[model samples]
Target: MERGRDTILLEGLRILDLTYGPSGGYAGRLFAESGAHVTKVVTGDQEISTFKDSRKRMIRTTDNQLPETIAEQLAVGHWDIVLWDSHMALHLESQLASLLEKISGSCLSVRIHFPSTVDVKEEHALQEWGGWTSLTGDPHRSPLYIGGFPATSLVGAHTAAATMFAWLEQKKGFVQVDALTVVVSALEGVYTNYLETGEVRERVGNRHHTLTPMSIFPCQNGFSFIGAPVDEQWELLERWMGRAPNPNWASVDERQQSYPALEHCIADWTQGMEREELFHTGQAFRLPFGDVQTLEDVKRCPHLNMRHFWKGQHPSDGIQLPWIIYRHSSCKLENRSHSLKRLRILDLTSMWSGPYCTRLFADHGAEVIKVEAPHRPDGIRGNSGESPAPFFNELNRNKCGITLDLRQEEERAKFLKLVATSDILIDNFSPRVMENFGLTREVLWAQQPGLIIMSLSAFGQTGPYRDYVGYGPTLESMSGLASLTGYRDGIPWLPGFSISDIGAGIHGTFALLAALYFQRRFGNGLAVDLSQYEAAIQLIGDYIIEETFSPTPLQPVGCTSIAELAIQDQRPLEVKTSDGKRSISTPWIIDNPENQTYEPAPTLGQHNPLLEDYMAKREWHHQL
Candidate 1:
């Protein structure tokens, strides 16, 4: 084993955050939070207000001139990453790809922008988020820009995930994340549905196409909502309301067909009760329920205080904000490099959630073995018609792919053998799929006591919706995000991105990392039950908490930005945070996983011998 190595996850990650807006700042903040040495560079006369987005985490600032030799200077500094904001600087500088190529260094240059086409005149104008969101929402209703600004945070988070992956492999290239591309990627199925089913998902007002009883209803004092996507939850809510359960609304399709009536039934019960009484009573039976919350209620939420989420004060107003959104209870710093080269993960996930989570691991230097079925491989790979799709390549990069017919008895046994040698196993199948394959938690624990199995599902392993079907829209609706997303009094609009699935992946990554650390430290097993719906609800958790106490039901306020939404009807605050601290990151070390590169996905059954050999070794070691 290596000795005396010292670092955090991103200890030597020196980043030049030259972005001018929230997206770039959000990306920088992610790296900074992960222990990167981030320098928010001020080039030309860029306004100071740009720093307000991430002022709390930023530790360094530099006054610099972007000369003709700007690329050369960046290379000379040996910065590990340069997160450049391409949208705001497009007019002032050369095209991003060219500038990045001219720079000679191993540093990863990330370009954040709005999606564009080849028409130069048209492309630059379409970079604003308002233009993009205009294409979304009800065609009848005006194109809504929620809060009237770009959704930079969504792109920024994805950029951070990609950059960390690149950094782990010593890869040098320009990574581009446009607002348009990220949003579409988030809502991948929208295009796929159009391609396969010839149906466009319309802007349905405050309800999912399938899930019944998922809308904001008027309460005694205000409006509230419930998302009983499953039969049991609906039944439970019916019992709680002292009414006969609608036997016809047992299935999602059935519920959709009679959504108006189902909604009316829920509204009838919720409208009479006090919002607080309903909130506490419904939760007692574990109903997927909540009320709408005002910003004032969000500010004073006790749940947020219990979580330590709103620990950080805003740079301008000293108002509280979330410090840590993804929480893990145990993560200790050992005297070693934060590399996952020694770890082996069995990735049995595909189509965003599971694959994305394992990609985070693979990019962090873990040896990820992605297992696909012989008859049906990853849906993304099958969808790749001709050219290499960035959609597939980006998420499945840095992992070994092998096919296994886990349904077959022989292949299933071989999988169990492989499992005994693996550190972690991850999947996003319906809760029963693993049990059906005889890969239950009890079976896994009996064979490999220390193994960590993360079963990511739409409703988790034990919920009433455990066996229910789901998609990205299912989460958006069921999680109550759709309830508060569109214009007030208008239909609840779905965002361009599959925000829920992406969040689950990111949060799942954090959960697995913590579980792995715990196993290594305490010799214990961890089972991560990641509910996509539950994970997604965290994004709008304050809204739920607020409505639980407040008299008002929060309605969709068409916001261009959170900055606008937070201020409500008041004037926007533009307080300058000029006192950001300064610190330089440590130099990169020699002992690293940079020497290793990702093994490409194997052709079907091509690597069968490798698995057979691994099983043989496992059998020999176990004296079987």
Candidate 2:
């Protein structure tokens, strides 16, 4: 476990560990191993627990009362980075402010939280942000929550990287992050998909919108994912089966109509072989064929093991954490030793921006410690009435978690002690939120001269809409993504997909890396103000530009022009009789084409528990 800490990534940094719950914890876990000194500060009662034999210990603090004195003490010391959940600032703004005034300078502070719809008053903070909930969902229907803690957790990583940038620049000032910005970053690819084709992707029930032979196929026991993106792979598949393309399934459209027959044919051939054989066969043909592995399968994949994607470590007692890697690099020997190497992070800015940003850091190669309040947990945790579900786990992979009642005078002291040695800090609360929490940039700079800080929110901290509330769906609607999808013949619809939130994470990683590069070169600090809603809007840049330049502006899918095109081009040309039933007939002829289809979305909470147990056992026993 100790050996892993010496990883060539973040070798010479100190991280003040103070992230409560799974989201922040996941971030801290990543930074800790890359040679960062992450001192997890917890209330004394919260003993460190390690489900496996990992070395990192969860420091349990004796003080659970509000107003963290530990945080103040840590801030007064020599630290580089600071991480915290949003509630820490909201609940302990006063106490933290006083401490911040007293601290030296140079330390970065990070805070993460969920957006709130309700207004916040002293001792009465309400959430329900605008972007996340409104932007990505159908306007007519009630907004539905997308399940994925990564959306929020990666915000933590953003906070971390942005803080590091400021530290390297020796900058001093409060910073804020926008959740919508993070969403936009992650959705760039999807947005590009639309721009390249002038087609907004609809909820096609997991079917590919344009690509053929790229869908989930049913197997004997479960499902397997397959992708034959090119014609060569398709030809290889046919050769493997020793059969030519059927006449009815020649073209893409024809294959859609004759889907049943194609499905049967493919299943007959695949069902006869073993799962390994099928996987190997696909690999042999240079096709992408992956099993729908359970969490357990993820733990045991040989490729992952060879690549060292998951770290086997016993942090304390009962928890077995398999550190997952989302970022990687092949070269790190001469370029900066550590100080965050092989660690790529994307911090999607939002109310809970810091958490989402840092989660990715933890996954790759960075010790990200998130600071949060025990009295007030992250809003997203309580939103669905399930605090730490798979949603949290998925986002917080490979990080450490802890609590800091920043309001307490004593806990503030502990926070300083931890921060004296960190790499970055991020926050998504409003501009005043940090001031209220006693985390002004001056205070952090006094503590650590080279600390980077990133502030994320709905709008930037300095913007007019900085205080807006935003969640996934709301952000979709606000970012104009929701207005782009739907049946071409009907009204524009909100995509059920949470592309905004996910895209932000990817974008955050890119931004964080750029900031990190500046830090390493200058040895100074910086403060980055990230806007989540603006970030979401960035994903649709081409659309915005085209609208400004084109004579006829593009509207949503169901606009008049699109509706006309659909009627003329896509209406079923004729009806057909199959057996005794009448069915729609495809216009084009098909000789033998792949029947690319997808199964239903996996049921919520359908992860395999037995496999989880086995993986847990492996984590407990040894480094496999």
Model 2 regions more than 4 Å off: 1-8, 43-64, 89-91, 101-104, 117-149, 169-172, 188-201, 246-265, 308-624
Q: What number of backbone clashes does candidate 1 have, counting pairs of residues 3 or more apart or in separate chains?
A: 14
Q: Cα lDDT of all candidates, in order?
A: 0.55, 0.43
For candidate 2, lDDT tens digit of each residue in 121-193? 1001110121223233344443333222234444444444545544444544344443323332333223222
Among all candidates shown, the one with the greatest TM-score: 1
RMSD to truth, every model: 12.0, 24.5
Clash totals, every prediction: 14, 219
Model 1 stretches with alpha carbons more than 4 Å out: 1-8, 43-65, 68-76, 88-103, 117-140, 147-150, 312-343, 346-356, 359-420, 423-484, 488-498, 506-624
Question: Against the hidden true structure, what lDDT does model 2 obtain?
Answer: 0.43
Candidate with top lDDT is 1
For model 2 the TM-score comes to 0.46
